[model samples]
Target: MVDRPNKPSAIAPAASAPQPTVDIADDNSSITATLPSGENVTVLLHGATVTSWKSGPGAEKKENLWVSEKAVLDGSKPVRGGIPLVFPIFGAPPANHATSKLPQHGFARNLRWEYLGKSTSESTTSGDAGTGPTDNSVKLDFGLYSANLTDEQQDQWPYDFGLVYSVTLSRDTLQTMLNVRNEGQLGFDFQMLLHTYFRIGDIGSTAITGLSGVTYTDKVLNATEHAQAENAVRIAGETDRVYKRIPQSTTSIVEGDKPRFDVVRDNLPDTVVWNPFKEKAAAMADFAPDGDYVHMVCVEAGYVSDWVRLEPGDTWEGGQRLRSLL
Candidate 1:
């Protein structure tokens, strides 16, 4: 018989490691979720805006979202940067439309939201034998309803609707999902968008891919329509084009041949690329250090090309997933 090494005593399973955490601010202003790997995301209760998202650990860590230095985070006005939620209307309300009396970009980004707690899960990449390293993710949910709106806001575009906005953060990705439910006896029409601002090394060195051959309406040029001629769009001047009916679901922001971010959307067919450039950037009081506009860009995903009519007792859902390649 082969001499087996003296059987070692059975080892007790290691104590469960400390899991990720969700922390609420003492003043009930923001909620932050941090993973064991040091990646973190913070969402302000005001507007349910995602104001910060940092990836990596220690020296390799970087802030992927941009918030203006002069942004009014004290709930005075809408935060100037980060991912600000837009609903009911995209820009100025159209004449004689159901949302005509609503303010620009609607009231979603200007009101406070209630935190609806969090959920945690683990995801794994496919590998040999369908096994791979596990990544822990945390999702935070927020809610807003017609009852939560101000009296003046209700008078503008009254509709009994419930909005559930979920923000999910993992090791390498950040996903935001929105569910709109009609809670009243009457149906209403609205628009929705995730106005995401991404930080970049330099604006001139960056290019956006996946919009080639797509038709767009240039809001800066008196709403003229044009077809994209280049596969990769380089922002040379002020860009405020609404690209409708995107052929693909994925759009990438590349800087000097390296992919910085991949934005994937579901049930969102419109993309808005906007940069205030120099003149307009200086005109906005909230933009701050106007030159900083070169350090960021807004690649928004939404259903703004047309209004979505939500009938009574029905629900509509849409979302966008952002993967950081840096």
Candidate 2:
């Protein structure tokens, strides 16, 4: 884990104006958002992937997100940690689809995105300061269209589509939203997810709750179906599970007896809980040192169990909100 200093707060008044400002350098490919509350969220255009979200009070500041120490930042490959957006396909693409030629999680996380616009309380009714903690919300939008696709990329999928992804930062929570619009004359099927990697002081001391009785496909067990018998799921080794039909409630990765963070989802019916453990972590060059799994956990939210179908001129939306409760 990268050593980070705790700031006093991530919520406050936007400097100079009420509207939140988006910062991006032409020479640099990364985007940095500074909210009024001293909270900061950084993202890279290469993948439209959120790389860092830091916000909390003094002395006990918290870094809710996590990234691998050895993860490459030069855009050669997908960064191993933080929140990587997955689209078009989840695991391996089906051999029948044109998207099959793409990468494991499709090209959404590997392709660059164009910045749209930002919104804050000053410019909209959504963000109103002093309206409780939620008043500090700030939003940034990034778009990717099929016209920007490379020759090889077009050959891979060939579907004309427009995707606008948004990252909203507030006090303790960082919210993600994806809007998919079909621009082609034909319909297309796709899968999507926000692969979120959370920082854990100790994975051994952490357990997840709010998934009891849910049915899931155990990827580690060769796609066998099973019910979650335990109220709180704990990790002892390599775990790759795809939970289906998840409700729009709160799920959390608790540390010891207390909940450390919360993952709230909407329009997303799938939850992917994974940890590569020791052996797999050592095998991946992107994963730093050894035993890197001991410090992180992934509780992804998406619509992956069944393909989402979108007709021409239609749009679909999905979202996930991450908050640190500790």
Candidate 3:
């Protein structure tokens, strides 16, 4: 964990204007970044999980990320909601694989990450001749390396690798990017995913667009392959499907006729849509207020359809940007 200064340094305000700021918790367990526009984001060092994202400004601010009310925050377990980083492997690993002995979703989301500080950039939101109110954005970087893993975790998947996960907060968008670098002589195969749990008004009234015509594996139906026939996918029950090779990079979550969120992906070709519904939601110890399932949906972006092989000194990068339209 990073040590917080007695008097935390903040971005110096420019000419009495409210500038973007980044605050590390007194205990250095989490960090929060606030934009001048009133939008804010918070991330926990545990798993480098993004726990909150409030969009819009002032009285219109709204939470866009859904975190379970009972999610364990003491570093005892991987967070149940919000955005959890998945790496090395996704889901249960197959027999004899390099990650077979590892737990589901690998160790990235179960370990603490080091804080790497932050950077801020400003852009003109309006007006010409560089005379407009500046829209400020802040990017906070967190890192995890093979050395940071536990002895057991290192033995389970022995490989030298470094991961840098960056979360950027802007006026209306939240972006997350992950960069993976193989730091050893041996090549390794791995999978990665950004499991994002989005808050919604109502699951029944919400529809996901931009996956039509793509083939998907229905995890709920014995991992059977199926084609997506619906232009707008809606949830009615326990749904778990992995859409492979998405034709478009952008997908939207729409409530009624208005889009609530837009997810833009970069270098991530696969997307997973999941909703636990009633029974499974109640079965999970971390998911509180079981019925709250109707208010959240997971639209995850990743390269889980296949493994990515990284050779010595090679690097891989991928990310997603989420924009709140509500």
Clashing residue pairs in candidate 1, if any? none
Write one digit per residue (lDDT tens) for candidate 2, span 1-326. Answer: 86578856668765554445578867678888876656778888888989988888764457777899998777778888989999888989878775788879988988888988787753233446444333467788999999988899888888999999999987678999999999999899999999999988898999999899999999999999999999999999999999999764678999998888899998899899999999999999889767768899999998999999999999999989888886
Residue 45 of model 2, lDDT score: 83
Residue pairs that clash (backbone atoms under 3 angstroms), model 3: none
Q: What is candidate 1's lDDT per residue for 184-250, written digit by digit as tens?
A: 9999999999999999988999999999999999998999999999999888789999999898999
**Cα lDDT tens digits for candidate 3, 126-232:** 89836787888999999999999889998999999999999999988999999999999899999999999999989999999999999999999999999999899
Q: Which has the better lDDT: candidate 2, or candidate 3?
A: 3
RMSD of each: 3.1, 10.0, 8.6
> Would you list the C-alpha lDDT of every candidate in the order shown?
0.92, 0.86, 0.94
Backbone clashes per model, in order?
A: 0, 5, 0
lDDT of 3 at 87: 92
**CA deviation > 4 Å runs, candidate 3:** 1-16
